[model samples]
Target: MQDPVVEYINRHPNAGWKADMNSRFSNYTVGQFKHLLGVLPTPKNVIEDVPVRAYPKGLKLPKQFDARKAWPQCSSVQDILDQGHCGSCWAFGAAEALSDRFCIHYNVNVTLSENDLVACCGFQCGDGCEGGYPLAAWQYFISSGVVTAECDPYFDDAGCQHPGCEPLYPTPQCQKQCKDLNQNWVDSKRYSATAYRIASKPYDIMTEVFTNGPVEVSFSVFEDFAHYKSGVYKYIKGDYMGGHAVKLIGWGTSDDGVDYWLVANSWNRSWGEDGLFKIARGTNECGIEEDVVAGMPSTKNLVVDSAVAAEQRASW
Candidate 1:
């Protein structure tokens, strides 16, 4: 059978992107695919007042920019994380971007725990895997702090072992202790020194990514998005599914003369152009430019002093 999303996209050759059913969503029912769209609108907060920076005067952004190229040292920016069948994109987006920022600022790679934010951030962050607010995840980063992957890791994947989708997964229980008995939960937590929303202007967001690292953005996901394959994605057609979150790494103009934002999705490498897609830029086509959130990770927190370590060891 022909996939309508792919068929419609193919009918228009100049759409600047292609579509096909041979994707991770090929067998996923619409209901099942919706599980990944997990970002909710965060209410106006003080975070917006703290802009990453005022858009600099005469600042020229390159026509082609990609974060992976700029920060080869940062492995998080390069890796495409999977959200599995869980709607924890909100947590994944924030966690992954902060992980990238930690490496960018400190020159050391540390994979912070998305599990901490997903399972731990309470009602203020929204309903966890069902859906969550991006800003709240950031607030949790500073307030409660997130542990390293070794301490928690992502547990949602283990529950989604089949190719077909299962019922909506509930948020896992918060684990105050590390998975490994030897690790101290408190000391393993990584804190962010600061987190804030970037100004909604195109260049301001660009400067934020250029100077620091990747940022997390939530956007309106349409039905057509599930079938995207290559080129720059613009909402060509489809019913509104829900709000979705992803990592924004860079921006560039595609060969079709369409300007696009380079984004990394958490749907795994087998999906959507190797887990990365370029969406229409500057226009906020999917409300992407409006909700960029990132922060300066406190590398100091990643270090566990010998005194604290000894105390934890003795207590254990």
Candidate 2:
């Protein structure tokens, strides 16, 4: 019996297979040889910042969920193949966080290359997607600007071949070799967990964060996402445990009265109504109230187009 990683690599022809099960990955617990997967039970509800106070005025949020405006806006939640059923939520979380910030910082609304991060950012952090830190992933982006999601998408065991897509920024040989830039980007996009953990008001931090633009954050999907076959999911299973990489672009509730957190999922439009899903707010992922992490936008002097900046100020 070949190892899951090796077995996956064997079936695939071109993917650069790199795996280290021993490395500290995300929240999932892996048994011997992909036998069984485990997830960390939702920790006791610690007093964290409510998502209402942070929310920008007029922005609608899920009823049960919290953290409305905790961080900046992000793109959408994308579902990448878990890859041979490997639990590497930590890597996906980091990639998702960076993807949204990358788009906002550059003002581009394209998907980010999470696969590249999974394949490349190994030695620096845990390997095989078992565990990782959002902070460390941000640092890597500073040192290396990731490629557009168009260049590389997470391939399932079947593999991918999107045309004109290359993992590197410009050069083929230099793929994954990011441009060295000032680390200031890190400070600007940094999100603080403590802030969300200590808020009192019903602040919609997610709304406030998106007021500027979409930002990325990670969360555990409890077994709920697995059975999520369509319109407004509330019931979830306890057998599955995994960390999924998703983007949170905007929020809204449906007319059904089942308050939902409008999130853009990456499972391709086919999975959930145009790749969009409505999680039962706080129910999934230990009540969205506590799962707040911000991808702080860059605070560097806003480089406004001279024409646009002047006109905007005149109106003000």
Local accuracy of candidate 2 as per-residue lDDT tens digits, 1-316:
2145434433444322222222112223333222112122323332222232353367664444322243324333233323333333444555565445434444434454555555555544334334444334444454444454455545433222245532122111224432333323322232212112212122453554444333334455543344343455543333335444444555545566554555554434444545555654434433444444444323233343566545433532
User: What TM-score does prediction 2 earn?
Assistant: 0.52
lDDT by residue for model 1 (49-129), tens: 664545666877788889999999889889998887788999999999998987776666888888888889878788888
Q: Against the unseen true structure, what C-alpha lDDT does each candidate score?
A: 0.83, 0.40
Tell me the deviation in Å of residue 227 in model 1.
0.4
**lDDT for model 2:** 0.40
**In model 2, which runs have C-alpha deviations exceeding 4 angstroms?**
1-106, 109-111, 128-131, 149-202, 282-285, 297-316
Indicate the TM-score of model 1. Answer: 0.90
Query: What is the lDDT for 196 in model 2?
Result: 24
Backbone clash numbers for all candidates listed: 0, 50
Q: Pick the candidate with the highest TM-score.
A: 1
